[model samples]
Target: MAQPTTSILCTDLGFDWPDGTTVLDGFHLAVGPGRTGLIGLNGAGKSTLLRLLAGELTPASGTVRVGGELGYLPQDLTLDTTQRVDEALGIRAAREALHAIESGDTDERHYAAVGDDWDVEERARATLDRLGLARLDLDRTTGELSGGEAVLLHLAALLLRRPDVLLLDEPTNNLDRHARSLLYEAVASWHGVMVIVSHDRELLQHVDQIADLRAGSVTWYGGNFADYERTVAAQQETAERLVRVAEADVQRQKRDLIEARTKLERSASYGKKRSESRNDPKIISGKLKRQAQETAGRVRGMHTERLTEAKERLTAAEEAVRDDAEIRIDLPRTAVPAGRTVLNLDHVRLPYGTRAHLELRGPERVALVGRNGSGKSTLLRAVAGEIGPLEGEISTPVPLRHLPQRLDLLDDGLTVVGNVKSYAPAADDNAIRARLARFQFRGGRADQLAGTLSGGERFRATLAALLLADPPPQLLMLDEPTNNLDLASVRQLTQALAAYRGALIVASHDLPFLRGLGITRWLELDGELRTIDPM
Candidate 1:
């Protein structure tokens, strides 16, 4: 019944990159005990703000205060492969000390280490179990786990800390559906202050509030993502209406100004004619002319001022609208005939000894869905000819390209244009630049080094190169392509896919994304491929 307590606060926070690019300026936020989802377009500085709050990055100015201990899981996570689970959980030393005491070694140092945490092992196991890692052993090395399992283990360690404030950045990036469900459960059970930066709509649905970050400022929205969407849509409708009204007012004022000028011109002509005809005294005529001139000037100035104000109103109204561009390119060359066989797998022995047999015709779109460590990537690689299966006959009648989740297909040292050039050796420089522009890499942006690009930019660059390959690929395979993309980028990808007429084989855990792709077939890759209804 009581109001939740404030656990995080930032006042007049400011930060800028070393290149003098400002990200946040005079930012202010106060978060209480509840989950808050932070969302924004790519390059909106969401990660930057989280880093500042976690004390991982120093702010250029202003103060950040936390009411209690904090736990942070960054988007770019890297764990030491050789570290034991208990060590990663910050309890290995205590467990060892406890064991020594139980074995009749009563050293004071061991007793000190085991002071008040005699049940540490039990608590660790319980936390792991709660995270759906019940089968995992504390002594197991981190290298023995899958990528998604590693992410869950990291989250479990943070939960064991029991910090009052928790920060997560794209926590579901590597997690499978089951692991994502487990994470959602953990989030639902948390009573502390939680701030998560994620593009996952399902994850955002569990939050108590949404923090819309844009141009270095945060706007609060009550309720979940769907609620936020409805509210934002209403706002956009109002803004658009205002813009229309302002535009009309500007047109009206312009017409009035034109009429005023015409009247003034007529009055001046009449006055000159009267003076030339000598119809009245010179002084009286002059005085009459002066009054007419003054009236015309006032009317014209008034109309001009009204028009300027109307233009200003229109500008203000337009500012309220958001720009989320769609990819509208037509990939005609990528289209395949109805009877064309794009790919065929004849009793292929996939990784982990799973056998798969399939045939894809025309532009059939297949979505590969399954739990983590189910060999999705391995299968995709085999299809792309990046690797060969132990036993099988595979055939690809059309050019195929694979987009891996890591997006490591790009050369870090090369520019985007250079990468595209390598993929399309026959295309000239001007032609390459022109095509790159369609991918949102206009002019100088195409010159940026791949290593320095943000996640979304790198994805775009990779996509551009793949789509713009020398012969124009007729079949595309993507593995978790939306992993770290922002909402806008995901929409861009969806739009791009919608325009493609080629066959698609995409392996993704994001149901919304896969659905948006208009998948014609759903294939679950458990140990082997099996056709199933779409999720």
Candidate 2:
């Protein structure tokens, strides 16, 4: 094996829970050169392992040895209250440090703080520029940027540290497709060992390895995301077959044990006298009969216990093996008026102080693509009736619901169930609970403060609200619905859309999904909607 430029060796890594629960098992992870995509469902010990590798959390049982420097940017980052994008990236601070260093009044202490080199300020600026944050407002404070923007700025800061190992947990969670592209390119060109946990299948394809964590152990898969899927599918099929075989064996063992005991069942033909003799026990004949009965009972009990234990063992073994992902969703019926133009905006020009005009129509399932702030959301809002155009009018002659890019539809303070209730009040709790279950948000999860839910859960909850509404929106308008979703969720959502009959106006950057869905038409940010000619 060629020595990795950077690597971390984790042996039997484990972590305990607050309630003496073991969240991380004897998980062994070998992180090395190139990109590695770490993935797991919500409570699956993925984040815990990432924290261990980053040194933020220590293992309860194992040693973590890092071969080189490591930089980490968590999915959720807390910035200094008054920090600006530029300051967070160390650009402005670096400049200030330099000014103080050059104006030195023989103060060696200050010089050492900024790295013995006076040119460090220049390097900071160069790094910030490479991160596309060169034009950031240094004094204005990060409170001005959106969640997605804040994530990017902090990522730039970590990159500034230039660690040999780079770890980003769900880095693309809140970013738009364009922003995600920025990450994709950066990770591809990065030379250090990079470990990432993202829900984007396309993003996972960029990695060199896939690690599946389950049942307290780690299974390593070579190759990228696509390769892993095929292998996993085959493995799941075999596992299911094995489960059936094990079950059959357990049943067969139970029958054999029962039959063996039945054979040992003594005949009662010795009559009541023999039976009474066994009961009396003082007579020799009675003693012999009692001994035989006692031996037979013991033998049967032993056989039963062993078979029962075998059955239990088989059950545990079956569960320990990996299974198929749960992807079934039941979206309630919503009627899209047949043979009618759902949305129409002819010679529709956007109002003053915004992006240009365009002629478009509803009942059109098309993607909206453009660079960030090139007016994708602005146009979407116009279609959603949140904004009015100065130059022309947009007529929505059909029932429609829009899932925005920023997910601004939500008010942060409500609980998951409460927010969902706001959309469909008349839905009895059971019906609502069922809908939430389909989206993987039910029970205490639905009771959790929506604000506390992770990016993915929040997005999913929002989707549940939209699709499970009273009448369900026939025409669905979504703004980058894939932003916070992991690759599995994205795939599931895509599968759901595949079966949808209503008109869809979506804005997404997942090219594979776009092509897979055979999206027939699209509108660009410049008020241009083009149809892909059918072959």
Candidate 3:
């Protein structure tokens, strides 16, 4: 492996949205060769930072210095549909020149075009194969490829460049299991500086380190996600202990101050009474009274200062404890009886020509796993009645709702509450807003236009709209629900699903996420759908 020629450095980096929302301020980071996973909450500027480093976006004020070549893959990657695979790989000219030379053209221009990468085609093919795109034809147009395949192709192109610094934003979002495995292998074998922003737990496990972006800053962890979690948990336990100790200290200090004040007040009262009773010498009485008042002030100040210091310590201790809130929700109305049959597919031929025979009972949680283009979304749409099956029939006994990958159920012009209201006309605005609040949209946020929401926020709004529907969907089908969600959002989704009592059939490649949901059945789809062991 080639050593890094230059490290990625950022000094006094600052960035803001067009609307003047500051995302990064005077930020600094120095990254050398090693795979680093960038994890953060939604709207943490992970993607923006990557774009700035890639030159896709300019920092407001700062320096971004890269020692060597850089390649970047954005979250939403789009290629010209008319462009051929060879062109997309960036080797069209070279490949054509090589072909001309092989045909005995003997043109000097051809040689110049080929340069030293005479085996570029072979290398490209090898790279594609490594990314599980071995069957993709170099001459084929990109229009024919699926979303996941396009991502793999783009990665192959970047790998061919042998860049010193590579950045990927949510690379595995829409990828299938096979593609994810290939990506994991690539990351494991990477020798250069790699920064990836993703919520995929499996992908994060392969990184050498984790960079947590929060509150417009980055905190580095020495190992992968699991290690990071362990370290954070340990730190949180210590913080909680400190907070408890600090609270106890504050209480003690408060009591001490009160007791001291009471004693001083009582002593002052006694001194005044004694002075009044004595009336021996005016000068002596005055001196004694002044001394008592001064002493009381001194004592009061000392106790007050100690209490203030204790309270400050308590505040600092509380600040040290992380306040990452968990999603608390209830979906009792979505429940189905244990013996209720929620769905039945009898020899149903999917749009992709594959036949599926399956039955979902009670509140069974099913995971639909397959390759990228194996019709998971298609089948999901069929079940949702968005599209009809080619043959046979699909029987859904309860109210069903489908959360598609694109989240098109929401109208961009409508507010989050308005979208929900559209779905459940009988539901009042207050009721809808209350349910939206459970999905993390509170107060004014519930009235924010769907078009203005971030990717994660949009997904949550869509989910809220679905679950908050009148009659409450008892058969929920989600297609790639975790695609653009941050780790926190993903966990929120998991928590929400945990409370849901409806039957679920989610098509996703996130194995950890599926297992977290306690899936009752594992179904794999290739040309046909079949049950598989939960490995």
Candidate 4:
């Protein structure tokens, strides 16, 4: 098939980590104009590929070509906390020059700086408003902005540049529902070439196409994420059917081989008897015996070859099927009684003027959601006893564990097994290893240092440590647990939560994840907790 026109292209791209671990070898991609969602497992080199395209990382071999000016938003966008918002937006110089020109200074340098972009401030404000950041003050420092707001500000800066190609890595990682909607709108209206590496389903739904990266290769699927899923499902079905057919073919071949051997044996036995009874010459008898043996050998060889080919076909067919592993564990000890009062908060006042009066009982799953800076994290910390409520009485009748968004609970210097061991010090090494294995940390992986683990691995490690603590938690609180997790990791988390028979409270803006948790109550934290319908 003829290749489509491309604004970004990577030809035979090869890259390796400092430790010589190969990431992408001979990888090739051609992304045309329009938005493309690049998705894969956590460590499938999606981010690495973006860095290569953005010139942040050099390939070990091969070349990357981009059509025009490019703008990139990394997953970990770091802005100097002391820097002013206008400076971070890359409009401070222009704004200053315009002010000077208006103040009666006709300096050539001022005019040169404000060249053609005389309306930079107005455009900047409009862009910020479009991204749901109109409340952000340009004169204020970025340190005052929330994580989601910082991301939006960076995106706004990129928008101002109006590059021919744009790359976003997990752009909605910390965004709330409203902010994500704004981002989706921006993506929908983008006319230039764009590639976004993200696990956000809603963001993926806005893409023009889906580029699935697996095993260092890219497979193009037309339409959005839903369409890609449907196509993949159909392909898997066909692959499974082929595998069954190949398996049957192998079985038939084996049966034919057995029958051929049996028939040859019978013919040889009959011939031997006939030769003996006819009193044929010894030489003639020997020749006939040899011929019979040769015939049997050829038949056996042919049948063996047929069976081997069938098995090979089966292997190929099976290879086409995906086997994404899911986490499965039973935590019976975490179960809460039907009438048990897990937590109670009476006129609780949280940070930022948020208040709540709520009672959580039994194994109720609650989803706490709201806009950016709405204090969902503050509420979770209060429940977990990590932070005290400003003015309220909080009670927890049962033990609880909290998984914060940063996942900073684990010691980077310690191994995954060591971190778990620290949490469950009373448990023996064998017991700890056994539990960690269930979290998909088997053998050497369990010994891997927490600092070196990938985003998905880190999340799993943190979860295992929390769940396997000395006292099994009856109430589990998670704050934006899916922030940096890939889709597979999110599914794995859902599976793990499914096995936990405990009261759960998750603070997140991910409506799909919250819905999948079977939330019994939906509470929005907009200065006060109020019951809301399921999202």
Best by lDDT, which number? 4
Worst 10 residues of 2 by lDDT: 526-535
Location of the lowest summed lDDT over 10 successive residues in candidate 3: 320-329
Candidate 2 stretches with Cα past 4 Å from truth are 1-5, 9-30, 45-65, 77-161, 173-179, 213-218, 253-310, 321-325, 347-364, 405-422, 433-459, 513-518, 526-535
lDDT of 3 by residue, 317-375 (tens): 99888755566889899999989999999999976678899988899999999887888
Looking at model 3, the pairs that clash are none
Which of the two candidates, 1 or 3, achieves a greater TM-score against the reference? Answer: 3
RMSD of each: 2.7, 5.7, 2.6, 3.0
Between prediction 1 and prediction 2, the one with superior lDDT is: 1
Give the TM-score of each candidate: 0.92, 0.74, 0.93, 0.92
Relative to the unseen true structure, what is the C-alpha lDDT of residue 117 in candidate 4, on a scale of 0 to 100? 100
Steric clashes per prediction: 0, 5, 0, 0
Against the reference, the lDDT scores of all candidates come to: 0.90, 0.72, 0.90, 0.92
Write model 4 residue lDDT over 96-192, tens digit each, in one string. 9999999999999999999999999999999999998898888888888888889999999999999999999999998989999999999999998
Off by over 4 Å in 1: 1-6, 106-108, 279-289, 409-438, 441-452
Residues 339-424, model 1: lDDT tens digits = 89999999999768667899999999999988988888898999898889899888998999999887899999999999999999
Model 4 residue 79 CA deviation (Å) reads 0.7
